[model samples]
Target: MFMLKQQKAKIIDEVTKSLSNAQLILLTDYKGMNVENITKLRDDLRKVDAEYKVMKNTLLKISLTNVGLSIDDLSGSLEGTTAILYTDKDPVMALKVLYNFIEENGNIPVVKSGFFERKFIDQAQAKEFSALPPKEVLLAQLVGQIQAPIYSLHAVLSGMLRKLVYVLDGIKDKKPN
Candidate 1:
């Protein structure tokens, strides 16, 4: 039908555009998830600037071509209901949100695969990536770790100077006329 064709075209356009801009693209199985649940998940993803969409696999393939990505094995995973999760920045945030959603919902949704920096990731690798900390938290922890040695050195040096000053003050106080 005309409607189906039009929808396919629109989806191809969207997916092609997404592939060009997104830092990461993730595929998921959203079979048991209801519309309300999907809406909530979309809201959660939006809060962190990730995009979520359900699209036809054929359209996805066409779009993949536009973005110079090809997958020969995607047919197996493309059988069921499929949705894409993506972000232009902070791939880990998008993966984390999806992982948390699945964890909270007892696996109502499943991660199929992901593409990050032109590299494809299987479900297990995607899960591992998601298990890592968020970018900001990881950055903050790294900064703290890097600064800790400097802070300790400063404290030690200051303590020694303070002790030397106190020793000089004590000698001055005890000086005989």
Candidate 2:
């Protein structure tokens, strides 16, 4: 009995640490998935610096409370074969991996809900979040947007300088030597 209590305590502590460090926490219903599929999913998530953990809903609720998140807000998500996908690194990459895995596996394990950026998101929101492009791609798009106007301005200035130079040469040639 004492050993069981100790194990539960250890699990709660580990889950609490994970919750505290996670930037994105997605709750998935991993029912009807075989061990092979789950292992594959875990491997894919690990590639993107995310972790997939299956935990008891009660322990997860305790962890959420320990992490200062209101359990009421997430009560609905903490039900039925909860598998957590969590990451402190690029969340979009992790999401992409999960969604891709779902697509390939005929969507067996469904995303129930999620907590991102300290906000609770429903299943639809989690799907939308997964559809987002990776961080590097978004960063590149932002950089392109920022540089477009600057490049246009440089081109305009260069054209004006070229015209000025041409006019100056014409005037000098007409004046003599």
Indicate which candidate wins on lDDT.
Answer: 2
Q: Over the stretch 67-113, how does candidate 2's per-residue lDDT look in tens digits? A: 88777777778887999889989887888899889999999689988
Off by over 4 Å in 2: 1-3
For residues 33-151, could you state the per-residue lDDT of candidate 1 as single tens digits? Answer: 99998998999999889988887777777787788876665656666788888889888888888888998988968888868877888899888888888888999999999999999
True-vs-predicted CA distance for residue 112, candidate 2, Å: 0.7
Candidate 1, clashing residue pairs?
none
> What alpha-carbon RMSD in Å does predicted model 1 have with respect to the real structure?
3.1
TM-scores for all candidates: the values are: 0.76, 0.91
Which whole-number lDDT from 0 to 100 does residue 44 have in model 2? Answer: 92
TM-score, model 1 to reference: 0.76
